[model samples]
Every structure is written in C-alpha cells, then in structure tokens.
Target: MISFFKKFEEEGILGINRRIGEYILPYNPREYYPLVDDKWKTAELARQFHVPMPYHYGLVNTFGGIRNTRELIKGRPGFVVKPANGGMGNGILVITGESEYDNGSIIFHKADEKKITEKELYHHVSGILSGLYSLDGNSDSCILQERLECHTFFREISFRGIPDIRVIVFLGYPVMAMLRLPTKESGGRANLHQGALGVGIDLRTGTLTHSVCNDKIIHLHPDTKRKLSGRVIPCWEIILQMASRCFDMSGLGYLGVDIVLDELRGPLLLEMNARPGLGIQIANRMGLLDRLRLVERIHDPADGPKDRVHRMLQEL
Candidate 1:
C-alpha cells in the first residue's frame, strides 16, 4: 500500500484523499455546497448571473404534482424528468415525443424509442420524489426541463445522447477539461461511470487530445468507430467564459462546470459539481497536481472571468 501511493504521487495524480484535503476541503466551503448540489438552485443562480442553461419547464415536488405530468410537458415536443439533487445520472427519464389518440390515451417515447405510458411516467417521478435517487436520504423535488437538441458536431460523435464539456475551475481560473460522450451502455446519459467516454480536450486549442473508458485508453469510439482525436470544440471561448463566471456565481473556488451544446443555443450550463471526480486525469493521461499547483501559484483574485480564462489559456 505504501509503494502504491508512492507510484500515484510519482505520477503526480491527485488521489481522493489528497484531492479532498488539499483542494475540495480548502477551496470549497460547505455553506455554498447547495448552490452546486441542487440543480434547481444552480439554475436560479445562473439566472441571476445571466449564465445560459436549460429552460425549466416546471417543478414537481409533491406526489399530487405527478398527476399533472402531461400539463408540465403540455406544448413541448420532448422533456426531461430528473431528481434535482440526483448524481451520476440516476433516476433521469427522457421523454422524446408523445402521441395522443382519440380516446385521450397518450403514449410517450423514450430516447431508446421505448414506449412509456402516462401511469408509468408518474410512477417514476414518484420514485424520484421519494429520495430514491437523491444524494441524501431525504425527499427531493423533480425538475421538469426542456429537452435540448444536440449540436451537429456532437451528434455525429455521440451515440444517442447529448455530449457535455466539463471544465475544472480553480480559483476562477480554468484548469482542465474533458468531453463526456454517452454510449449505449450508459442509456444515453453523458456520465462516465456508466460506460460513457471521457475525452480530454486541449485547454489551449479546444481540440481533442485523448480518451478513456473505464480507465482504459482507446483511440476509436467503441460503437461509432470514429477516431476520437483532433476534433475541435465549438464555441470554445464562450464555453470557457461561462465556466469561469460560474466560480463567481457559486462562490466556490474549486468546482466542475458542465456545459452542453444545443442546436439553437451554442452552449448551456448543465450543472456544477463541487466534488468533481479524478477520472479526468486518466482520460487526459496527465495528473492534475501540477496544473493545480501552477494555478495556485499565479491565480489572481482581482482578475475577472475573461481575464482569468485568457491567462490560463496562455500559461496552462
């Protein structure tokens, strides 16, 4: 065990214990955790900061609100139902489309084209409200969100779901970034733990550099067979600005800003994670300790979001 830790430090990889004690614990205050943990709260903060995010169709907190699920999604072509405090993509239901019949019976289509009835959808929301997927064992509210269309760039690379870019911001300076692509095994969710692909991005050029799945390196996508390198991310500068601004909005020195590209809207803030994972190092084939140490040495508290992003791009 001693030698194993020695190897981790030799590689400069940020282990869980050190990550918490050095970065998360010191940079992230416990009081501001709710700003990032609860998706609804994050959305409210984004509104105050003028940061773009997915539209909130409505909120379903009570079991009684579950009855009006159809009303929540009335005029929309598709909608997403998810626990506001859920993590790792658990208890997320995406309804792609719906068809109404003369008898008033309607059928909903999932991302997989699987049909779901209204009763079944209500049951799923009920389960979310029961704290089944919440981070804590407490009742949670469900967020009814507008289903965004994937940008053309990601649609060609992703299997059947949207891809999101995760930028790790330290003291309002951008440090590392990775693009998470969904696969069939992940049920069309851009979550790395559930068999999705984590592709590292070049912070300087917004280009793809490396990729990994389950900590194993791969050059081509498992299903698409597309070469997973050299593709440049669109709206890269705007995305970085949004990520840096989130630091001010949330008041957390260290956090992960998840952003997605919409067909209409260029990039929308998906959510923020105060305790971001370390798998990003494996995907980038580089340790985070050096980059983080560099940021700590030169990060300026007086600089604004745009200035911070510029410095990181030039120096990191």
Candidate 2:
C-alpha cells in the first residue's frame, strides 16, 4: 500500500481532493459558474465574444413549449435536443432524420436507428423541461441546436457519433487536450464514462499520442479497430487559440473548453466547464500538477489569447 501511494506521488497523479483544493477552488469563482453552467447562457455569451458555437434553433422553457417542438425545428432533418443545465452528455437527444406519414404526422429516427413518433419526441422535451437530466435537478429549459456533421478526420476513426476535443485551459493558457471519440457502447455520445474513447493529444503538435477507455490504455479503437495514435488534428492552432479565448470570455481561471470539428463549420465551441473532470490525466498519462504550477508562475495576464496559446504550448 505504501509503495503504491509513493508511486502515484512520484508520478504527480492528482487525486480528486487535491484537484478541487488546488485548482478548482482557488481558480474558479462561484459568481462566474453560471456563465458555463447553462448552455443557453453560454450561447448568448459566445455571440458577444464572436466565438463560434452550434446554431440554436430555439429554446423551450415551459411545458407548453414542448407542444411546439416540431414547429421550432421547422422541418430540420437533423437536430439535437438537450437540457440547458445538463451535464455529462445526459438529457441529450439526437434526431438524425425524419419521414412524414401519409396523415402528415412526422416519424423521427434517432442516431441509434430507433424510430420515435412525434408524441414520444414531445415527451422527451417535456422531461427536459422538468429537469429530469439537469445538473441541479431543477426545472430546466430545452435547447434545439443544429446537429453538426462529423468531420472527415473523425469519421475515419470514430465509430458512430460526433467526436469532440476537450481542452484544459488554466489562467488563459491551454495546458492539455484530449480527443473524445464516440463509441457504439456509448450510444454515439462522446462521453468517457459512457464508454467513449479518450485519446491524448500533444499540446505543441496536434498528433495523438495515447488513448484510454474505461481507465485502461489501448491503441486501436474498440469499435472501429483503427490505430488511434499518429493522427494529427486539423486546424490545431485555431482550436488552441479558440480555447484560450474562452477563458478570457468566461473569466474563469481554470476551465475546460469542449470543441467539435464540423465538416462545414470547422471548429465550433460546444460549451465550457468550470469544474472539469480529472480523467484527462489518465488519457494523457500525465498529471496536471506541473502544468498548473507552471501556469501559476509564468502566465502573463497582459498577453492576448493567441500569445497565451503560443507561449504556453511552447513552454509545456
């Protein structure tokens, strides 16, 4: 037991308690959490900073709005329905396509290939409005967002759902990043706990180095059977700069920025997390202690977003 603990200490593995005490509590402010907690509010803030995000068709705040879900979508072949305050990819519904019946009622197809009627879709929206999947379990609003097509790079490696990049930024500097690839087991959602794959990415270069699933290291994707390493992320610099800019936008010293590559839109910000999980360390086979300390010691508040990204990546 002693040796096990000593090894972890030598490796600088950050445990949960240390993460919250040393990073979250000291760097993140309570007042600024709301900006990232509510997806709808984050969209409004993204517009102010000119940060690109998924297009929102509309929001359903009340149970009555659930009845208008179809009208709000306005015949979009593909769209996403999620709670404004949801977390961990819960309360998210993906409508991949739809066909109308002869009677004019629409039948929707989910990403999983299950068919859903208009009534079932409305019920899901109503559940979101009731906060069934919300972070705080309070009444929540439902967001109707544009479903982005998978980028070609990810489509080659991922199983079914959209793959997204998770960037950990501290003091406006990007310290580490991971590519979250959706898997069939995860129901096509890029969530690690749901069996999605987390691939470590080099901060300086966009090349993938290592991958982990269910806390175990692996090279080939479980479902796709493709080699996970050596794949370089396209538009790497732009993604880093955009993630750094989010810290400036949210005013959170420690932050997690989720970005997705859209086939048409390039990189789009999904949302920000003030209390990002520590699973990134496992994916990268590294600890956040050294990087966090470096940021605390050398970060220049006067530097612009681009400068912060360049300087930090070089330093790391």
Candidate 3:
C-alpha cells in the first residue's frame, strides 16, 4: 500500500490544495467568479457571447416565484430545475416527462422513475430558494432549463441520464478532457462522486483512453458492460472550440468547460468552472503538473483553437 501511494505521489497526482493554491488562485480572478458561480448569470453571459447552452424558461429567485413555476414550465415536454448557486451536482432536478389527469393535477416523472406533483415541485424550488444546495448556503436562484437529449453515442453507454464532457482549458487551450457517464448508482446524475464513470479523452483526437468509477480504475461501463476506450467523441473539434472560446468569454486563465452533445444542436456549453476538479488526471492515469507546465511554455499569440489543438497533436 505504501509503494502504491508512493507511485501516485511520484506521478504527481494533483491534490485540491495544490490545485487551488497553484493554478486556480493564480489564474482565476475573484470578480469574475459570479459569472460562472451563478447559473443565471452564466446563461446571460452565454447569450451575449453566442455560446450555445440549454434554453432556460425562467428563473425563480424568491419563494413566491415557486408558485408560478407550474405555469412557466407547463408547455415544456421536459425540463431541468437547478439552483443557480449550487455546486457538486447538488440541488438539480431533472423532470423527464409529465402527465395531467382529470382533476387538473399533474404528475411529473423524474429520471429515477419517482413521481412528483406540481406542489412537490414547487416545494423543491422553494428549497432551492432557501439555499439548501448552494455552495455557501445563501439564498439562491432557481432556473428551469430545457432538458437535453443525449447524443446517440452516449445513450448506449449511459443509463437513464445525459453524460457531459469536461475539458480543462489553460490559457485558451484545451489541455485535458474527460467524458462523465451516468450509471444507476448516480440515480441518473452525471456526477463522479455519485458513482458516474469518468472516461479520459485524447485532447487532440477525442479518442477514449481510460476510465474510472468511485475513484477506482475501470475499463468497462458498469451498466452497459461495454469497453470504455477508443470510441471517438462526436463533434470533437466543435467541443474543443467551444471550450477554447470560454477563456475570452469568462476571463478565467485556467478553467473547466463542461459541454454536452445535443442530438440536434450538436455540442452545447453546459457550464464553466473557475475551480475545476483534478479528477481528470486520475481518469487519464497521468499527471497534470507536467501537462500544465508544458502548456505554460508554449504560448503563441497567433494560435487559434484549431492551431492550439494541432500544435498539441503534432508534439504528441
């Protein structure tokens, strides 16, 4: 056990303290955090920058707004309710579908097959307004966004949820990427700690390379039992392009760009993170310190997204 741990240290596994102290603290400015921390603000910024994201119906910022949610989302076939200030995939409610009865009461179907009523939905939104799931336990805004249909490729590997790609971007260049796949254990949420699989992808080629679940290495998806490597991500270049552009949009030097592939829209920017986790190194079975240091050395002002991607590939 000691040798195994030593190997991890020798490989330079990035810890949270080092990540925050070295990369995040140095690159991310304090003033711009609200743009990414608050989902409502993030959506507004995306609109101004023409970055594609899930369509939001409206925001419920107060407890009173919760009472009006049913009318707001009434016509939608499916939707997601999330706290604008939430983190770690908490306080997110995905309503897959709904049914109305003769009494005018509606029943909503969750991804996990549990049923909820309109009143219950309102209550959940109220909880969000009270900051039950926010990062700092402060009053939060609740947003209802259009539910995304998973791309065909991920639908086969994921179980009852949409998976998203996480690309770690440094100084306008995408350095590392990973695909987060939801499993039954995550209750249909694509969160790593909730038991979703993290599959590493080649930065240039978007080819699957390695995977992990519950912090343990794995090669096959738990539910699909399919090999987790070699599959190419659809719209790979577009995904990286979106990630690269986020640097200018948010002004964060080092960031994580979360993107999802919509069946019709292709790749959409789900969100951006000022302090992205260091799990990509674990999933890729590599060290981020080296890649980060290497990226720091090669800074060319003339490089575009395509140029940066090509430069990395050429060096590889």
How large an RMSD does model 2 have?
Answer: 1.0
Error of 3 at 30 (Å): 0.6
| lDDT for each residue of candidate 2 in 1-316, tens digit (9 for 90 to 100) | 9999888888888788887988889888999999999999999999999999999999999987787877889868699999999999998999899998899998899997888999999999999988899999999999999999999998879977899999999999999899999998999999999999999999999999999999999999998899989989999999999999999899999889999999999999999999899999999999888888888888888999999988987787
Per-residue CA lDDT of model 3 for 76-107, tens digit only, reads 98999999999879989999999989998999
lDDT of each: 0.91, 0.92, 0.89
lDDT ranking, high to low? 2, 1, 3
Q: TM-scores of all models?
A: 0.98, 0.98, 0.95
Clashing pairs in 3: none
Which segments of candidate 1 are over 4 A away from where they belong? none
Please give, for residues 121-156, the per-residue lDDT of candidate 1 as tens digits: 888999999999999868999999999999999877
Candidate 2 regions exceeding 4 Å error are none
Best by lDDT: 2
